[model samples]
Target chain A: MTTALTVETDPAQLCCEPSSQPVLNAVDAQESARVLKALSDPNRLRLLSIVKAGDGGEACVCDLTEPLDLGQPTVSHHLKILVDAGLLEREKRGTWAYYSLVPGALEAASARILGL
Target chain B: MTTALTVETDPAQLCCEPSSQPVLNAVDAQESARVLKALSDPNRLRLLSIVKAGDGGEACVCDLTEPLDLGQPTVSHHLKILVDAGLLEREKRGTWAYYSLVPGALEAASARILGL
Candidate 1:
């Protein structure tokens, strides 16, 4: 039952009883979609990938800018969006701000498509 | 080294060699972001959820609209987006169109945040 058949070639069958698995409610969908929307931008995902691939799973805006080939302000803007979506944590140290992936953020996003 | 510090309490430390893991490139990011963006709408995620939670892991627009309280056209629009994003496969039979989740689409997305 883990695999579902394509309805094109076969008749529709109910593999499980009706309402067996709970569905996502409107509120949950809204919250999850908000977080996902923040991550929809290519620049943002790249920034996230860089931070995740960084040593200690963290990176500063300055570190990302060189390889990102983007201005410091642009990188900071992306970081801000990620932080707002709770996907990244931001901290300032003297002069530079660093970013790290928030625990469970990615997993939560992944869980959605699995009907979580 | 999997857990990263908040940087508020500790000095930065590089836990691994530089550029140890491959990161997402611009092209990959763009492609991935497009899929995630399509999934970013609340109504769309809800529609996906109902389809995913279906007994055979598939659903027709008629099957979704009652619980969703959405008009048929509205539900169909959402489904079209999912299909276009390659998250769902659509097939027409007589009149109704049935949909099933595309394999590995969700995993590919989840893998991105993990720097895959």
Candidate 2:
């Protein structure tokens, strides 16, 4: 079952398996790649960093835009990308949107890439 | 110097500093993004995984191509990319080129992204 069909079609099926065992198939590679690509951007990475470095490990859009120096829309776009990628969780608090890193997103991605 | 010139012009300058303190600058975000982009590919991730899961935590090109189901040239191309990214080390032995994960490559990238 080392075909591309097994690898490209369903990523979640590839990595949702327990981590105690090593990933022995091509499917896992495809799935993990999707996650990595989502985190591969400079803006998205920075967004994650800001959120991770924020007080209580969370940040608002107002706080994030200042350090990024990008337009609010652009920062919002990047945050949306990270949120869509499942690496971040977004919540609207009144007029501002707050984002926080998903608890296990980084660790899960690390495990998938490192096979830990 | 929180301008784009400071962030985009040089990435190494952004993240080469120690990680004891939080990365509060835009430069750190930009440089760390470069490293993350380098590891974003499935082929590169798989290459790292195979090397990590190898007998001695290292693997040769001959061993990598089989698992990847990719041409030797493609695997070679990916290995070169990883090497260039400082995530892998290559040691040529006889007619074979062996690749191993550089120690701390993942950890550093993780620290950059997770701010840990």
Q: What overall lDDT, based on C-alpha atoms, would model 1 receive against the true structure?
A: 0.74
Q: Which stretch of 10 consecutive residues in model 1 chain B shows the poorest summed lDDT? A: B12-21
In model 1, the Cα lDDT at residue A103 comes to 88
Stretches of candidate 1 exceeding 4 Å from the true structure: A1-22, B1-22
lDDT per model vs. reference: 0.74, 0.71
True contacts kept of each: 0.49, 0.27
Clashing pairs in 2: none
lDDT of 2 at B34: 71
Docking class of predicted structure 1: acceptable
Chain B TM-score of every predicted model: 0.73, 0.75
Interface-residue RMSD per candidate?
5.4, 10.2
Q: Write the per-residue lDDT of candidate 2 for residues B1-116, one digit (tens) a residue.
A: 57977777553343222223334455665677677777777777767777788768777666777666788789888888888888899998766777888898878877664453
lDDT comparing candidate 2 with the true structure: 0.71
